[model samples]
Target: MGERLAGAEKEVLVEIVRFTQKNGLKGAEGGWKDFLARNDKKFGASVSDPKKRTKDVLLAFLVTFSKDFQKYFRKLVRRHAERRAIEQYMNEFSGRISPEQKLVQLTTEHLDYRKNYYFPSYQEGWKVMRIGKVSSSMNSGAMLAIDCEMVLCHDGTEAVVRVCVVDNKLEVKLDTLVNPLKAVADYRTHITGVSKKDLEGVTCSLVDIQKSLKKILAKGKILVGHSLYRDLYALKFDYSRVIDTAYIFKYANLPTTSTASLNSLCKSVCGYSVREDGEPHNCLKDAEAAMNLVTAKLKHGFNDPIEIAENSVPEPDQMKLLAHRIPVYLPCQELLKIFSGNPSIDEKIDSRIRGEFYSTCISFNDIDEADKAFDELDGQETKDSSGRLQKSVLLKRDNGDVAGFFVRKMVYGSRLSNSEVLKKRPQPTENTEQKKEDANGDNRKRQRTSKKHAKKAKAPVVE
Candidate 1:
């Protein structure tokens, strides 16, 4: 059986080692020194106080013996003791029961797994709906990012949580306290940093925090977060639409082979240096940092192109253009009518009426048929009088149906001059006048040849 120590015990061991190493000791000699001194004061007292003395001596002897064993046979003894505990715990488990209420057992098992694993469970029935696929599908709308912080506290202990939202939406919600949920509070007089008083006035229940978070996140529209699975699991929210920044970053080839945490991603991509002024693991700061990360990279570019925008593109004009020309999943078809060329519709059209067009075939009853016919043709990308590539496409379709598909070739986000980089379709070298003269000469030669043939046929007939 596998044996696992609790985080508190691991921390105790870590602290002991850290103290010993800093003081240049083989083991935890520093704490042992204090232990010895405290024991001497209690045990080496008058014989009249024999009860206290005996207890103190016993404790001192145990400490000394443990230290000696640690020096001589460190890992072996620890492992053996751990294995014994593991076996005892495993043996004490009750046998599983197949209950009449099957759903009850399933839910109990589900909750147990989530709590034990400290992560969300993927229970969808689709073959492709695995953990990774669920993560991607839910987070696809991560556009309109938001950066924020969440403060978490328990048992008079406090910590900060940083959060980043992509597309201002959440797939999974989380309300977990950091530094392991059950860490001992070190309210030290020597170190006047974190204290009970500091976290006193602002203390609130987990549920209260969750409610507040819900309000704050109402604007997110969609959520994109890092290790969001764990957070959502903790929050008890079955958030299915969250885009895991960790997953997206890795897929984008951002040098993150392992589970990409926010801190790691920030340091590598944006040269972000985490400050120690605030508590090390503030959720809000982390979230803000994440939002900044995607937007900055998107507005700019990535190491390669893999760092796709966690949210939809934010340019309003671009969005409007997309809304007008492409399918934006909206109901209104205003922009669609603008593109169709109807001379009668032109009279109703306001010259200064600047609004986006949409793709809807339904004619508006209030507007005349000519006016309301969803302009499906003749709308061309408006060009400047001088004929430079002005933010839109130029009209070139032979059928006057700008509505139909056409090949578009332009260097996107290119720095090269238009004339230099954009190779126009090869123009005919010969002048139009010369081309016409050549065509006329060819027609005359064809006519003369036909006449000669006719004359030869007549001579044959006469013979």
Candidate 2:
């Protein structure tokens, strides 16, 4: 296992496949099923419901991860692998987990949540696990289009808010709002057509949607959508055969690398608009538009039309917002008092995470200013309830813990975005030692010159 960890390719799943005769090695006595049984204790959960261990129950836990999540996971894995060099052991149960269940295990875990969020799931979703699958199965005639709308999560990532599926026959199969496992960051009502009230009692999970799509697309089925890769990614399902209308149809005077929007294709090719300007998107309409676009393409013998016109792409998010987690109950009124008593939070003293230190989080209109106030309040000398300044206050995370969480843990408060921006902000280069030496040399020269002038004036007076 150590040798495999040290190998050039550290992908664990690939090594499993290499043991088979398909990879030119003599076949192992039992294949993956036998291997899974032998290594059950490594990859499987320490305590799982016996009923959920059945093959039919496998679909319940399958998840696809965001690129950010995958990146973080690989980084953590690399860190653990380095620790192994110094005799640290990998988690005994890390291997027991099946590939399908790797996602959302972070539901309650941190640092281990590499299979999770950041930058939303719209971009960077389906670059891999496609053409390879297509090459294997060259003759699957079935195709269906899928689309998803997402809202931001509290942790600064995207979660699917709605999903829609439409078949080639212009029939709607599935269209429903999803309940994000994480808290909503932004409903994006202007674009997603999803409001907080829309998802109030929505009990649909990502797994449920994935299972529904899997049922629609059994195996080797062609999945279609405008930017279908992202839909698959947001759904966290991996299917190989896909028809991306965004790619199949092209806009005039545009590069192939750039994709045409479903709205644009519908307007120019299908002679319609999915939605009007400044209107929220309808995924069912969008999905059906994609299906229609594909149908038109098939009618045109899969060739992009010469009369293809251009349409504008959706604008990227411009709000560079950030938040800080306060381990203690620092109320909005207290925060405003700290921020020069200004209504910095727009008098919007609201919180989804409430009543506790760990659950309490805040963001400021001005980060540096808010952080300044936060540090002062969370500092040693803070005003008491009676408006008296108290020194020697206990630290926020000072729960009399046995050891520190990180090597360089925070003694004071810090904002998530503030710390990140500080890391990226360049420090001014200074030669302090050189400046000191120059100053000292100038001082010595001045002293010597003053002494000579005084001595000469005194001698002349004496003469």
Q: Candidate 2 lDDT, tens digit per residue, 1-463?
A: 2222223233332322322212222213243334344547665543232222543222111112233434433433343343343221114444443221121121112231222211122234422222223222333456677889988888986789899887778788898889997888789899898899988888998878877876777754567777665666666665444566665543433322234567766776778889888888988888888878777766664344333342234322001111223333444333333222132332232222233321212334444544354334422333222222222222222233221010011112122244554563444456998788888999997877887675643211100
Tell me the spans in candidate 2 whose CA falls farther than 4 Å from its real position. 1-137, 302-463
Candidate 1 local lDDT, 205-312, one digit each (tens): 444544645654452234445555555544444433233454443223211112334654666566664334333454445566655565555455443433323221
Per-model root-mean-square deviation over C-alphas: 29.3, 20.0
Show model 1 residue runs off by greater than 4 Å.
1-195, 216-220, 251-257, 276-279, 300-463
On a 0 to 100 scale, what is the lDDT of residue 232 in model 1?
A: 55
- Quantify all predictions' global Cα lDDT against the true fold: 0.35, 0.47
Instruction: For candidate 2, give the lDDT of residue 416.
Output: 26
Residue 114 local lDDT, model 1: 24
Error of 1 at 323 (Å): 50
User: What is the alpha-carbon lDDT for the whole of candidate 1?
Assistant: 0.35
**TM-score of predicted model 1?**
0.27
Give the range of the ten consecutive residues with the poorest summed lDDT in model 2: 402-411
